[model samples]
Target: MNPEEIGLEKPGRAYFAPDDLNDPALTRLIFRLGLPAVAGLSINAVHHTINMVFVGMIGAHEIAAITVVLPILMMIGAIGEGLGVGVATAIGRALGSNSPQRANVTASTFMVLAVPMGIALTAGILVFRRELLGLFGASEAIMPLAEHYLIIVAFSVTLTMLQILSDFIAISEGNTRFSMWTLLGCFALNIILDPIMIFGFGFGLAGAAMATILSQIAAIAAYALYFRKRIGTLHLSARFAAFRADILKPVLSIGLPTTLTSMLSSISFAVLFTYAGFYRGDAGIAGVGIALRVLTLGMLPVIGLSLGGQAVLSFAWGAGKTPRLLAASNLLLLLTSAFCVAYGLGAVLLRYPIAAIFTDDLEIARIAALTIVVTHIPFIFFGMRQILVVLLQAQGRARLAATISIAQNGYFLLPLLFVLPHFLGFEGLLASLFLAPALTALLSAVILFTTLRQLRGDTDLPIATFTNTVSERAS
Candidate 1:
């Protein structure tokens, strides 16, 4: 079939058909896939920021309590996030290669597995709860609140993984709208419930946790409803749940690097929080944590673009459509890089105002503002590296992706975390955040260049000839 003969959306179509991935206008296709992913993520980040704001009102130490608990939460969420990425890549490639049964089985198998993994994690975490709290820099004063928050939050793990898998599977098969609504609905419910549970019912930290799980429950309900409708390409069912080494291996290989990267971030943040607590006490820890949250919120858009772009890239790769892959890579880089530069400048301009939203304490706000300046601004350049990592994953080049993933935090940030603090005190802790991404971006540039060169040679032609290769694999 030619590009014109491929599946495209009809007026009454509920979602884009799998093969429709190749024929949509590049800009429309990328954004149609990307925008909702970013919107949900950005709003969710807003929820966290606002949660910090609500928590801030209780006391600075409560903020400190949250600061300490976040890394632990991230560590848990990373499992779902990482696994979801793996599932998405696998399914997207499978569909592009015209294997719907593989797509169906992959979703069913992973969803079945996610529940047990989440349950085991919750059990393990609760068993080791206090130790983890202390390990992440929860001081004696913050420990009770952190523990209080975490105990309630832990039970949501199974549901969390379920929701993530459902959302990613939906996204992979060209059904991002429902996934977006799931996230947005969860965000709405959590926000509405946060104040009610925290202040109205006087649950405090426990209230926030209650609100979170309730929102997650609602999200899972929504996903279940959507999946039952069977509007999209894949139908997830227990009938398809049998394990196959073939599916699990590629999924793990593609996914674990991302999990490690997120975990490394959690570890680095834990280490940073410890330093902040040592140098600046409760206020510093809260301030630094707040800044980091802001940094993540800011990166959401571009990160969303990169991930969304990855689906497109992976589809093209599996179809052996050289020009579509190159077009995707080019457009993604252009859009993400532009947004990052613009957002970084906005970070510089609004640092104080942004930080002030999370806390009333002048010292914490000032510290957060300074951190935004030091951390958020330079972190813009990471957009380049972020896109590169996702691009590599899209191409199913796990080794290269894993190497880039490690370079981000493991090689650059983790080493710098200890070395810099030993030399320059608190300032150095912040400096590590700034420098690692910069260095990683430099390294990723070399890799990106080399990867592109290899792609050109592998395609058996130069960049100019890729455009003619679109129908090369439509068998």
Candidate 2:
């Protein structure tokens, strides 16, 4: 153990080890884990933007169809996210607590559960494709395009789930760089294939979905290859027989809330979409969709950093490293606040230019710009609050996390969607998006502050002393 004792890649330089997390400089550790994730997510967001541009080129109708279907697609992703985050948190905590055995078990169990669930989802979507889209308020004009896209992409769910889980597990093992590379490779492949599939092959909407499927397949292959090299402590193998309740419980506890939170987002957005359709038809859907896609570009970095922060916080919590936990909270607040200020200002200043990227229609672009400016005004508050929610999950405060997640949308967003439009009309619909996150942020800040205050007074070993002891033991 000591840094000196560990072998360097070359003569002078040392690569980051999982044990480096135990180092006292919590902020450096955050960047080491976070920056790669941010890069990966940024590239991923760019890839999506490019994909949207390609789809937009198909016409306003195609883009409108996509917007109508976006929430339902997000619902599919919600399950994968829940499982991935849950397992990742479980694995990270296991490693931090020095229980590699448990981490491996969690990984193995996840594969067993996730694969079947993905397959079932694909089958179900294919069977009830129309009903599912209809439930999300897909109008008659958009339904055909939605169906066409889902026909190809639905089957890709298994691979998509695998890719997501692999990325999260890799990050949990402190191998964020590898995860980043895998995602970059997929993004590159997706970009190269998109035009060829859509225009060259003339697959249209189906072609875009096919291109995405192919890219996900490439990502799954990459993850499998990387995991075979076994860079981390969590190893996925054929251990279906050794499945234990203990390993499954922690993963589910953290994951279930996270998954439900994501699904709620989809649900709330779908409800908003329904109202939008009632008020403004395809134009409303197209405008909101463009704005949301643009907003995602801003969110990618924040989410990447949040994922990094969550893994670090989970490890620290499991290791009983209070000072490191406090350091993580402070650093997340600083980083997110800075990002919010920068991104929010950019959104406000370049709202029209940003909206114009997706569509040539002046009406859609104007509405999109308005949506961007209004929704992003409280960007910093939303980003910090999200990190706090993830921290709650990482620290085994799943009930609190779940409560926050549910209330943010269910209690706040849904009611706004119904009431705002009646008074403010179409503008009220967009305003609801802004109000929900703002209110949720206020609530989360209060809870996070209270939690940190309690922890500060607790009789736990300080991070400085803990780091010194670890160093001495290593030496």
Candidate 3:
């Protein structure tokens, strides 16, 4: 697992071990780890926006088709992301506790588990494609397009899930550099294939899907070789892939909340689409969808920063290095808060231009810009909420993590989704996006301030023990 073999860094730097996470230069480590996570993850997430750009050329209806599919795509990816978080937490804790075997088992086991679940998800989606698509707000015109894109997407869900899981496994061991290269490889290949396949090959919407799966295939090969060539510490060999209940429990405890959080967020998108469709039509749906994608691209830095910090946070928390964990949390929140403010303002100012890039329809572009302004107005407060959710998860406060995870999308957003639309009509629905996170952040503040107060002195007190949140419930 030499860094040289994987092209991560020069030899003196050393591959990240659990102990290596204790580096006193906390700011430097965050940037070193955070930058790669941001680059790789941002690239992966941005490709979807790229896909929408190419598909937007076909028509608003085609854009609408992809829009509706976006929720379902997020739902599937949510499972992988959630599980990957679980894997990272478990392995991070294991390595922090100096248990290499435990780390090995967690990586191998999840790698094996994720693929079959991906296959199952694909099967189920394919079996009930019409029902699922309609449930997500697909109209007749969009249904055929959605199916065309979805059939190919369904088959590759397995690969997508594994790709996410693989990235986290590598990151968990502090191998973010490997994670970065593999994702960058996927991004570069996707960019190359998209235009060629969409127009050159005459595949249209289906071409985008083919390009995605093919790029994913290439990324998967890189991960396989990383292990096969002994470039990473954790091995995905056959013997360790066998399931064990002990491994499953803790992972699921942290992961289930994460999945629920992401699913709730994904479901919110579907519900938003449903309402947008009901109030406006394909145009409104297209408009809102474009706005959301634009917002997603804008927020990638925030997400990347959070993930990079998460790896370090989990490692420090696991090692019971309270002082380091405390410092890391402080810096993470500050950086997140600062970045969100800057991006939110820029996003609002540039809304019209950003929306214009996606579609030629003036109606769609206008609606998209309006949606962006409506959604981002309250973005300043959300930074705290996002970082707190990561902090809670890293601390293994599963119940709190799950609660916060859904705070915006579920507790606040869900009721708003239903009630607001009924009262204020479509404007109310759009308002819900602004209101949910804004409200959630205020509440997040209460919880966060209390915890920060408790650890104010950073005494050598073993940061509170982090057991599975499920176990807390059972007790």
Candidate 4:
């Protein structure tokens, strides 16, 4: 069948081939798919950094308050992200299996589940705002500011969840351009409004929160409209209310690991910050905060690339196109590793300038600069680990994915933090943070190679059958 006959148009003169891993035309196709997914994810990291840039101007206290609250927000948002990843992967697989009804069911189920959970999360945050902030090591001085920020953000949880779900839907349907536009537009709006609300209206920390919520609301609207018109067939059905265990099982399987991975990082940061506070006081926490924000700015785009790899590899796996899947995985590793190496070197070299943009205080900037140089040097392997995890999840190997998740967060990071500080002191703590992720990357590589070898032996599966199933389901 012609590409047009299957609802896919050739980008150029070359005809489409499912197994064309080495085709120049196919490489371009993968690039086209990967770039927008990268952009979509990067927009999220951009919003966080931009928010930090504005909040940093207010003072260290404001920065600390935001920092303390960030993990909680991420923990809460992890629920949505975890679920969204599951939905995206499942939808892609269903599309590959030529089960359009099942794909729609997956999409609809995500929406139904996300809304009530978001509402409950919002209410929980509002009711326990003070208590939650206290657990994160918030001081009396920072408590009020954190409370203000948390309340505003909590109320907008539904909008954020909706936007995330919509983005997943777009990516699953291979309409990443639409997802990218939604994120970019929201990011631009957030940037434009942050100054006005924070400085012009003197909203302080609350202003930043307001800007974030408003931007998310706009994104939600845009995504909703776009998905209804141009993306997948995600019509709501009464069956979604029935709560099919079979449908939700895969989502939860994938989502739980993803959530734990994020939560573990949040826990690690919280512990690290608390330790820094005990040993170094507010200055140390503020310094670490600045360093983290800088690191995020550098690492987020690589994460974007890894996410792109996840989407492509997951779809390819679902389609049983082992060659294409391997190609996509290797391409991501090569490209992202190169990017990380350059970024790590540049961060070390230009540490001062990057730190200075956040604050004028020479002491904080110096500490931040030093920390950035130390922490990011090991991130060269971080992207590879992330890509492998995504690949495993796409293939529905939840056990392996969960094990890697635990290894990265629980097994490696938590233990390192406890043990390293005993002998090395503060330096040990810092070293542990870097070492954990680097080790996680190495372990992930081993697992990926082993898994690929096993898949190679499974000779009964036919790639064309898989591809046809996906195409039929997607349509």
Candidate 5:
């Protein structure tokens, strides 16, 4: 059906129905899907960096406070991302299986789950704000600021969750441009409001949170309107109200592992912050926090590329195009690796200048520069791991994706951080970050190769059109 036929008002935009996957120009098709997704994710990374930059003007204490609370926010948001990934992958697969009705059910059920989750997260953060800050090893100086930031952020949890749901739905439906526009609008608002609220209004740390929350609310509103008017039939009627186990199972199954992986990363960050606080004090923690924000900026495009690849891979798999799925994964790995290598080199070369941009203090700059240099040594592997995990998740291999997720951040990274630091000190702490992703990538590559071999016997799956078309034309 045409987009218009499906109640989508946008007449000119391209739609990614299941049949679109059969297009012979596989690389072009994948690029179309992945590019806008990458752009949206990159914008998100920029938003975080901008927030940190503006907030850093206040002082190290302010920066440290934000660092303490930001991960907690990410952990909560991971719930939505994890669930969204599951929903998107399932929806794509259902569409591939020629089951539009099933896709609709999955989308609705995911929203239902998100509502309760948002409420629980909001309430939990409000009640346990102090405890959470304390666990992050916040200094007495930073505790009050952290509490202020957390309160505002906690209240915005529902809007953030809904925005994520909308983004996922749009991407899964092949409306990547819509997601991009939504993020662009929100990010623009955030950039404008950040300085105004933080400096002009003199809200300090709370102002930063307010800026973020307001942007999220705006995004949620935009997405809600777009979904209702432009996208397919999504209603709150009784027909859409009922939940299905079959739809819930795959979404949760894929989403839970990714969610757990994000949770582990958040925990790891907390542990690292605690260790930094004990050994280096507030300035050290703040420096590390600043470095992470920089890292977030550097890693943005890679993540965008990874997410874009994921959407393409998922769509291809859902369309039953196994060969295209495989090709897309390999192409993504190669492209991301090249970008990572270039980024790592540039980061090392511009270390001093980059650090200077974030802070004026020499010591903080030195620590941040060192952290950036060390953490990025395994950058290529990290990129590979990201692409592979997405590939596995899209293909319905959540267990493998989850394992890679844990290995990258949790299982290997955390222990290494504590152990290596005891012997080598700060350098060891830095080395652990590099080694974790490198090792995880190696392991993930092996697992992915093995999984593909096993799937060779599944002859019922459709071969990618690119390979098939080339073969047919030759004959």
Candidate 6:
């Protein structure tokens, strides 16, 4: 089918062909596709940073409360993010094959699946709100504040999930600009509403939660409008959205592993927070939380590029464009490594100032700056590892991706977490965070080397090999 038939605009720069993807100047392609996602995810990073800043305005205790709540939110949101990755892969693969019908079907099906999953998540959080917060080390003083914030945010879980799903759909279609704009609009609204709700209405933490929820609602509306206008041909009927074993089977194959990977990361953070609370009380939690937010600001470009690369890799893999895949892979590694190293250096130099932005307390700022320096020492390696994991997932190596995630973030990190602290005390615990990724990067390099060897060999690589392996496993 033609681009017109798929409701895609003619001459739109959003869509990329296998030939364009295979071009020697693939760096240009990477930049083109990745920049918007970078902008989008970066703004999100800034939004979270602002959240900490505003919350810090209240008190270190308030910041600590939100710090405890962050991982729980990530754990809940992982469901949608993980599943959206699968949906994006499926759509990218279908588009690569020039099958608009299949792409539309996959998108519609995911939209259907998001609803019940979101509802279940909301209900689960409502039911286990206290337990969830407590598990992350919300002390008696922090617990009430966290609970109040969570109760308001809980109602918007569905909106957040749906927005994630829509963003993935846009990304799959090579249109992250739409998603970026949507996020920017939402962040603007949140920025405006944050102070008004918090001080004007005297809501405190609950006000922040309300502003976030409203922002997500606005984002969802933006996505809806964009899809209605740009993706007009997509079928959203029950017939397409209905359960089909064929559609879900492969989607779940890719999605479940990603979900597990994200869940493991969440669990790792939860473990860190738990130990931090034990060692340094609320200050430890706030310090680590602020540091991670700052680190994420540096890492957002890597994440954005990796995400953009996933879509390209999925499409290229689906089309069986090995050369393009290799080219893209090289560019991804080079750019992510360089950007992260530079960003990490800047973070080190500016850590104190960055920390001070979040909190005026000298103790909290010092702790936060210390965490940033220690954790960012291995930032480049972690960035490389992250890109590789996303590439593996996009190339349909879900099990491998998930295995690496658990191995690095869970096994290595958790063990080091408990062991390292014995030698260096709390500093060792901070060291454990970066140390795991550094060691894991070595393991990732070996696996990545093996994959690259296969990609460069005479025999065909990409989807054919993946499909054969899947078939073998199924049989």
Best-matching candidate per TM-score: 1
Query: In terms of lDDT, which candidate is strongest?
Result: 1
What overall lDDT goes with each candidate model?
A: 0.83, 0.81, 0.82, 0.76, 0.78, 0.80
Consecutive 10-residue window with the lowest summed lDDT within model 3: 466-475
- Over the stretch 1-475, how does candidate 2's per-residue lDDT look in tens digits? 5654565343312232343557677888889888888999999999989999999999988987777667767877888888888888887777777777777878878877778888998999899989978877789988899888877888988887888888888888777777788889899999999999999999888888989988898888877776675655566786532557787778888888878887888888888878777887888888888888888888889989888877888787777666677879778878977997899888989999999888899888988898898778877676777777777877777889888878667789989998999899888887898898788888888998888786676436576876664443222
Q: Which parts of model 3 are misplaced by more than 4 Å?
A: 1-19, 457-475
| Lowest lDDT 10-residue stretch of candidate 2 | 10-19
All candidates' TM-scores? 0.93, 0.92, 0.93, 0.89, 0.91, 0.91
Error at 241, model 5, angstroms: 3.4
Off by over 4 Å in 2: 1-19, 240-242, 459-475
RMSD to truth, every model: 4.1, 4.2, 3.9, 4.7, 4.6, 3.8
What is the C-alpha local distance difference test score of candidate 3?
A: 0.82
Residue by residue across 189-240, what tens digits does model 3's lDDT show? 9989999999999999899889999999999998887787666667677688
lDDT for each residue of candidate 1 in 372-401, tens digit (9 for 90 to 100): 888866677777788888889887889899
Candidate 3 clashing pairs? none
Give lDDT tens digits, candidate 4, residues 1-475: 8776886765631221122222345457566667777777677777788788889889888988998998898887787788888988887777665566787878887887778898998899889888878777788878888888898888888887888777777676666666777788998999999999999998888999899889888988876665454334445454654368878998889998888888887888778787777666776777788888767776777766666556666666666666677767778777777878888888889989988888887877877887887778887777777777777888888889888877866889889888888788778878887888788877887997887776565434576765664454343
Select the stronger candidate by TM-score from 2 and 4. Answer: 2
Q: What lDDT does candidate 2 reach at residue 90?
A: 81
Candidate 2, residue 322: Cα displacement in angstroms equals 0.9
In candidate 3 the C-alpha lDDT for residue 65 amounts to 92
State the displacement of the C-alpha of residue 403, model 6, in Å, after optimal TM-score superposition: 2.0
Per-residue lDDT value at 65 in model 6: 88
Model 1 CA lDDT for position 313: 83
The global Cα lDDT (0 to 1) of model 4 is 0.76
Worst 10 residues of 4 by lDDT: 13-22
The candidate with the higher lDDT, 1 or 3, is 1
Off by over 4 Å in 5: 1-21, 232-239, 452-475
lDDT of 5 by residue, 1-475 (tens): 7666777745443342212544677677667767787788889988888788898899888889999997798798788888888888887776656667777778877777677878988999999999989887788989998998899889888888888887887777666777888899999999999999999999988899999989998998887777565443333222564465766788889998978988988888888888777777887797788777767776778776776567677767766666677777778878778888887888878888988887898888888888887776767566777787787888787787888888978889988987988998766777787788778878977986786675454434445744563343222
